[model samples]
Target: MRFLLIEDNVQLASAIVERLSLDGHVVDLAPCLADARAHCATAEYDLILLDIMLPDGDGRTFLADHRGRENATPVIVLTARSEVSDRVGVLDLGADDYIVKPFDFSEFEARCRAVLRRKGGASGNRISRGDLKFDTLAGTLQVAGEQIQLRNRELRLFEIFINAPGQIFSKSKLVDRLFSYDEDVSENAIEVYVGRLRKHLSASAANIVTVRGLGYKLEV
Candidate 1:
């Protein structure tokens, strides 16, 4: 999954980014509210890890503005404030979850998964379509009880498809999800990844189909 982490604490942000990247997530870091807003305006994220106390502005205000515009992207507030009112305030402002500072990484990961599952309408980390299974946590794909070997780009592309089975993804959207901000990748790169993924899934029960003028979607 792709995530935006809005935080100013270098140490904590680094640790979180490292851990999430190790778990096969593409994470973008924004040190302040201004940067976070800029990132949010440009790219779509599966989740947002927002710090309440930001260098430029309050994270709560950002959350309020996000919700005021009817954006439904899930957000998890990361803050040192553990007060009841603080938590309630952020939740009321449309945060899906809240994590206190100095919390366990395991718990943090679990919360992220839970929120993602809720957003994706999935019951668990394993997204299954027919005999094909994509394990979000393990970053593995299995077809008919056999594991399939895939490259990093192939795996990421498959993850996006498996997460939202029949939903059609435009080429531009897929490109955005596959590449990071700093990467100088073109839209054609998405086609290359999709072509490779199609070859890899040839023997599987699931397939990737093009939508002509639209883009691509997973067919099971």
Candidate 2:
């Protein structure tokens, strides 16, 4: 998954980027609201991790403006405020969830996964399509009872297809999904990843099919 992490504390932001990266998520860090806004204008994201107290501005105002612009990207607020009112305030401001400070990384990741599941309309952490079991949080795929270990790029590529089974996803969208803003992508990156995923699923019930000049789709 691709995420925008809006945080001012350099240490905390680096830690978060590292943690999310271990799960195969590409995280872009923004230290202030201005940087956040700039990132939003240029690239799309699956989620946004926002810090309520930023260097330049309050994140609540940004949340209001974000919702005002009809940007439905799911946002999880990272706040030091632990009071009930504080939590409610962010939610009222359109944050999907809030994580208090002094929290463990496990709890943080769990909250992220939960919010993503709700927003994506996925069933629990395990999204099932026919005999295929896809766990977005763990970044693992299982066909019938066989577990297939996917590399990071292959996982990201498969993630896009699993989310929207049977629907065509254009190559341009796939490129955006597979690579981060700063990553260098070759012309055949998508095709190479698709071929790898196809080989992995050859004996399984799921398959990926190309729609001549249109895009690609996952079929079961």
My TM-score estimates for the predictions, one after another, are 0.92, 0.93
Q: What is the C-alpha RMSD of each candidate to the true structure, in Å?
A: 1.7, 1.5
Best-fitting candidate, measured by TM-score? Answer: 2
lDDT for 38 in candidate 1 is 91
Query: Local error of candidate 2 at 46, Å?
Result: 0.6
lDDT of 1 by residue, 78-192 (tens): 9899999999999989999999998999999999999998998998988888989887777678887888766667777887898788999998998888777778888999989
Q: What is candidate 2's local distance difference test score?
A: 0.88
RMSD versus native structure for model 2: 1.5
Q: Candidate 2, residues 73-178: lDDT per residue as tens digits?
A: 9999999999999999999989998899867999999998888788778859888888788877677889878898888888877887887899998887787765
Clash counts per candidate, in order, are 0, 0
TM-score of 1: 0.92
TM-score between model 2 and native: 0.93
Give the worst 10-residue stretch by lDDT in candidate 2: 172-181
lDDT of all the models against the reference? 0.89, 0.88
